[model samples]
Every structure is written in structure tokens, then in C-alpha cells.
Target: MAFDSLSAFLAMGGHGVYVWAAWGVTGLLLVGVVIHARAERRALLRDLRRRARRAQYHGASGAAAPPISHQEGRARES
Candidate 1:
């Protein structure tokens, strides 16, 4: 089919409202999902790096307490 004008092309035989609305909402949500996923990935990576740094610092500082066995812990407590 051919349209005499741009308005006629958009009208789409009176079903344009439903069609355009669906397309617009779906496009918007898809973009929002991409943005949200990127943000979550960055935040999680930052937290992981921070935890790793703390662990490295503690290991290098040599002030970390030593682990004790269960029997040793009971003997110490007694």
C-alpha cells in the first residue's frame, strides 16, 4: 500500500495507536534492562575488588590471629 502523506503512513488503518504503543514500551524497557544490568555488574565488581584488597592487606600485615583446633580451643577455655 502507498500513502499520499506522512500522516496517513503513521495512521496504519486506525491500528497505529496499539502498534506504536507496544513498540515504544518494549523498546524503553529493553533499554532500561541493559542500563540496570551494567550498573549491577559494575557495583558487584567494585565490592569484590574491595574485599580482595582487604584480604591482601590483612595477609600482608601479619597481625591476623592464628586459627586454633577444637581441642586446643577447649583446653585454652578450661
Candidate 2:
């Protein structure tokens, strides 16, 4: 089938409302997914950068971070 004009093509045999609504919903959902993915990626990158800065700061301070165990602390002290 061929459309005689742009309006007729969009009308889609008088089901234009339902067809356009479905298309609009699908487009909006796709855009939402893209936005969510970008936000998550940015948050992950920011966390990674913050962690790197903390590690660098600790290294530059010249005192090693203490061990987590009491036994290790006692042995080091001895």
C-alpha cells in the first residue's frame, strides 16, 4: 500500500492515535534507559576517582595504614 500524502501515512488507516501513542511510549522508554545508563556510569567513574585519590593521599602521607588485626598490631609493636 502507498500513501497519497504525509497526513495519510501518519493516519495509519485511522489507527493513528494508538499507533502514535505506542511509538511515543517506546521512544520515551529508550531515552530513559540511555539517561539512566549514563548516570550510573558517571557515578561509578566518580567513585573510582575518589578511591584513587584516597589511596594516593594515604601513600603520600608516608605512614602505612595500620593492619586490621589486633594480633598483627601486637606483633608489630613487639
Candidate 3:
């Protein structure tokens, strides 16, 4: 099927209202999802950077981080 004119194409055989509304809602939802994901990723990265900074500060101060438990570390040679 071919649309011979722009107005007829937009009218979409008189079902344009439903079709256009569905398209608009889908576009809005897609945009919202993208924005939400970007925000979440930024927040997670910021938290990671903050922790890295804290670790560096502690290292520079010559403060030792807590040692891993022996059981969680290397096993002793039998």
C-alpha cells in the first residue's frame, strides 16, 4: 500500500488518533527509561569513586586496611 499524500498518510485511514497516541506514549516511555538508567549509572559510579578516594586517603595516611581473615586468605602449607 502507498500513501499518495501527506495528509492521507497522517490520517492513517482514520485510525490516526489511536496510532499516533500509541506512538507518542511509546516514545515518552523510552525516553524515561533511558534517563532513569543514566541516573542510576551515574549514582553508582559516583559511589565507586568516593570509595576509591577514601581508600587512597587511608593508604596515604599509612593506615593499614583490615586484613582479610586467614580462612578467607591463602591456606597454610601442610
Scored by lDDT, the top model is 2
Candidate 3 Cα errors over 4 Å, as ranges: 59-78
Superposition TM-score, candidate 1 onto the true structure:
0.55
Using TM-score as the measure, which candidate wins? 2
Residue by residue across 1-78, what tens digits does model 2's lDDT show?
588899998998899999999999999999999999999789668755665676787776423444334452356532
User: Model 1 Cα displacement at 16 (Å)?
Assistant: 2.2
Clashing pairs in 3: none
Which stretch of 10 consecutive residues in model 3 shows the poorest summed lDDT?
69-78
Q: What TM-score goes with each of the models?
A: 0.55, 0.62, 0.58
**RMSD each, Å:** 11.7, 11.0, 10.5
Residue 20, candidate 1: C-alpha displacement in angstroms: 1.1
Q: Give the TM-score of candidate 3.
A: 0.58
lDDT of 3 by residue, 1-78 (tens): 578799998999999999899999999999999999999789668755665687887776423434334562254221
Q: How accurate locally, in lDDT, is each candidate? A: 0.71, 0.74, 0.73
Question: How big is the positional error of residue 61 in model 3, measured in Å on the Cα after superposition?
Answer: 11
Q: lDDT tens string, model 1, 1-78?
A: 577887887887798898889999999999999999999789668755665676687776433533333463365422
Rank order (by lDDT, best first):
2, 3, 1
How well does candidate 1 score on lDDT at residue 14? 90
Clashing pairs in 2: none
- Pick the winner on TM-score between candidates 1 and 2: 2
